[model samples]
Target: MAEVLFYHLDRQPLDRVLPGLLEKCLERGWRSVVQLGSEERLEAIDAHLWTWREEGFLPHGTSKDGHAAMQPVWLTAGDDNPNEATVRFVADGAGLPDPAGYQRVVMLFDGNDNDAVDRARAAWKEVKAAGHDTTYWQQSDQGRWERKG
Candidate 1:
């Protein structure tokens, strides 16, 4: 089963919550997959995630296969766009399908990316149609993680 946790805060910095959350995952030696957009955001999360991982968070886990230290995916809008179109873009940058295999899958989205917003909607649809259990995000006043059925 996948559990979704939403933190409602207006001024809480991403720098603060991410490290602790990643560390929390490390405290128990659980395998985690961190997915986000852009190198800047990935680096920000990596500041702490990498440290925690190196400190024996998960010795054999924490794979940074795609990007520097996280799952780096780009968002695209239309056909023949620069790279991919995100979840709705019908490109390679697709969101998670089954988050059941891992302990936690944390996705950090800008919540303002046009393509990303649409992809999030599509992801919600995919989840419902496929009956996958994962923490999905729906943009609003506060970031809400809607679990798939």
Candidate 2:
């Protein structure tokens, strides 16, 4: 079963938290697909990954960039996993992809947004019911991720 990780974002925005998470995936030698809600958001994330830091790069490309299979991190607004990624990052309220195809699934939602939080809650229940190994992580008072459930 795929591991489902829920990230409740309160201490920071997705832009602040995403790059670091993607970096960790790279360190583990895992390819990832970051699925957003729309192409505009996907483009924004694509730009951010390139300039998030002065000396850092995440090695990502969107469908518009072509050669999807060659990218370590593939960005898309759709459900396609052209890179055969072992890890999938579902952001901006995007629905989960086929869990069996991924080793891990990460859903990041804004805790400050009521709708986002509610959606995450529903997702957690659905994932758990689907029999995946699930975990819920929330940001602490000091802006650190803590395993809450």
Candidate with the greatest lDDT versus the true structure:
2
The digit string of per-residue lDDT tens for model 1 on 22-66 reads 445556544344444444555544554445545543221222333
Clash number for candidate 2 = 0
Query: Candidate 2 lDDT (Cα, whole model)?
Result: 0.91
Candidate no. 1 TM-score: 0.45
lDDT by residue (1-149, candidate 2, tens digit) is 99999999988999999999999999999999999988889988999999999987779998789898899999999999999899999999798776888999999999899988898888889889999999999888898889988
| Candidate 1 minimal-lDDT segment of 10 residues | 80-89
Residue 41 displacement (Å), model 1: 4.6
Please provide the root mean square deviation of candidate 1 (C-alpha atoms, Å). Answer: 9.3
Alpha-carbon runs more than 4 Å astray in model 1: 1-14, 38-41, 48-94, 97-100, 134-149
